[model samples]
Target: MYKNGLKRIIDFICSLCALIILSPVLIILIVFGTIFMGGNPFFTQPRPGKNEKIFNLVKFRTMDNRKNKNGELLPDEVRLNQYGRFLRNTSLDELPELINILKGDMAVIGPRPQLVRDMVFMTDEQRKRHTVRPGLSGLAQVNGRNVITWEDKLKWDLKYIENITFLGDVSLILQTIGKVFKRADINREGTASDIDFGVYLLGKGEVSREEYNRKQAEAKELLKRR
Candidate 1:
């Protein structure tokens, strides 16, 4: 029923309507983001979508492109400016993902797409979140978002895919609205973004530092082709 096909229909209709209704906000974000974010107003990255497919997930760029002495991009905290913080806190930065939903790269609700690096670290069981389209807002997001442990996040994602229903999606959507209004769990502890899954695994002794480095390198190489 809903999971098989109806959900995609609703996601498309809702996102199309949302794009129309939110056009003004999107335009303003683009104008201001371009001005304050140095150049590019949008942040795009290769995210793992359904069945581990890669897609360019789009959002407003919240961090400036700053590099250290070695020309490596600075850490997220340093690059995250006040404007970026505002966008993050309000979740206005995510508005551009309507385009993703519109294009069928995502859904209005489902398991959120994670970084390619994160995807590589996922077990085969956990990666099953991709059985459905990625989401703009997801079960894991409303539960605890970036503050939740990766283990719990993956658990919720797996739970969502087991049985999706119209009522369930609506409930999650409503819960997501409330979470956004409260600006709850937007970031983990004091950081500007969630800790990388690969980093988390390294800390938990699940993966050796060498393995982490190697897999991260692989993810970077994959991004180059995207």
Candidate 2:
């Protein structure tokens, strides 16, 4: 009952309330983010949602667009300034995702949506993470977030999918709030972006380097055709 219907209802109500209640904070972040990041305050990117459907995921922009001499964007560490770090640590950067949840592109608790390009690299079991709506926070996030390996995160994601319940969702939500208050696992050592799941699979020999390169090439080709 909850999974098919009530869960979405609760998600809609909660997200709407959150947006209303957090409007001031959102406004402050938008103004500051625009001033510091020097672009739109919100970041929007295509992410794979339930059933591998793509949606534009939104979040507060927390990094500046710093380009190198050749005009390629600089690395995450170089672009993430002090103000950006504060937003990330406080998880204020995720505030805009409430809008996503309200729009039915995300849930309050479920597997986190992954980059659309990463979908081609996932194993059958890993692909199961998209069987449900993606989340703003999830079992994997509350468990270890960027601190855990991608395999471990996928395990948690699958576990959550298998055992999703109204009570379970509430529990995960509470745990997420606690973790955010403690500012736990905001980033992995030495970088703002965690280890890429595709790169990790290649490093562990789960996928050959040639396969990785081919998948990336295919994705790029598809993007050009689009």
Candidate 3:
């Protein structure tokens, strides 16, 4: 009962209240973002949501759009400034997702949405994570977050899906808050961001370079539908 219905109703109410309560913090971040991030404070990306549906996921911008002399964007490590790290470490970068939650594009808790390219590479069993709305903080998040391997992340996600309940979600939420307060598990082992699924697979020799490129083309074509 809670998994199929009560979850969304509670998610809506909680996200609405969270937005109302956190408005001041949001405004402060916006001002600081203008000064430090150079302009826009929000980042939007097309992500696969429930049932692999595409939606733009919103979050506070944690990387500047700095470009090299050639006019192309610089590497991600170069663009992720100190302010960005602070936002990421404290999990404040996720504040804007309350809007996504309120808008019904996400849930307060579920599997974190991955890139469209990542979606295309997923096996049908792994793709089951999309059976519910993506989330702001999830089992994978609280369980080791970006520090965990891609396989472990999906493993936890499936575990959560197998047993979503009101009490279970509440427990995860509490664990998330504690983890955030401790500033734990923000970035992966050696990278500033989580590793992309496609890249991970290619690195592990699970897919050939040719297959990777082909699937990327497939993902791009699907993305064009929006």
lDDT at residue 135 of model 1 (Cα atoms)? 95
Q: Ranking under TM-score, best-scoring first?
A: 3, 2, 1
For 1-226, candidate 2 gives per-residue lDDT tens digits of 9999999999999999999999998888889988998878888988889987778899888788999999999988899899988999999899899999999999999999987567778789899999999999999999999888788888899999997899999999999999999999877777678877778788899889899998888666655554
Write one digit per residue (lDDT tens) for candidate 1, span 15-118.
99999999998989999999999898999988989877899999999999999999999988999999999999999999989999999999999888999999
lDDT of 1 at 13: 97
Higher-TM-score candidate among 2 and 3? 3
Off by over 4 Å in 1: 221-226
Number of backbone clashes in candidate 3: 0
What C-alpha lDDT does candidate 2 achieve relative to the native structure? 0.88
Q: Rank the candidates by lDDT, best first.
A: 3, 1, 2
Cα lDDT tens digits for candidate 3, 64-120: 999989999988889999999899989999999998999899999999999999988
Which scores higher on lDDT, 2 or 3?
Answer: 3
Relative to the unseen true structure, what is the Cα RMSD of model 2? 1.5
Model 3, residue 80: distance off in Å is 0.8
Top of the candidates by TM-score: 3
| Model 1 pairs whose backbones collide | none
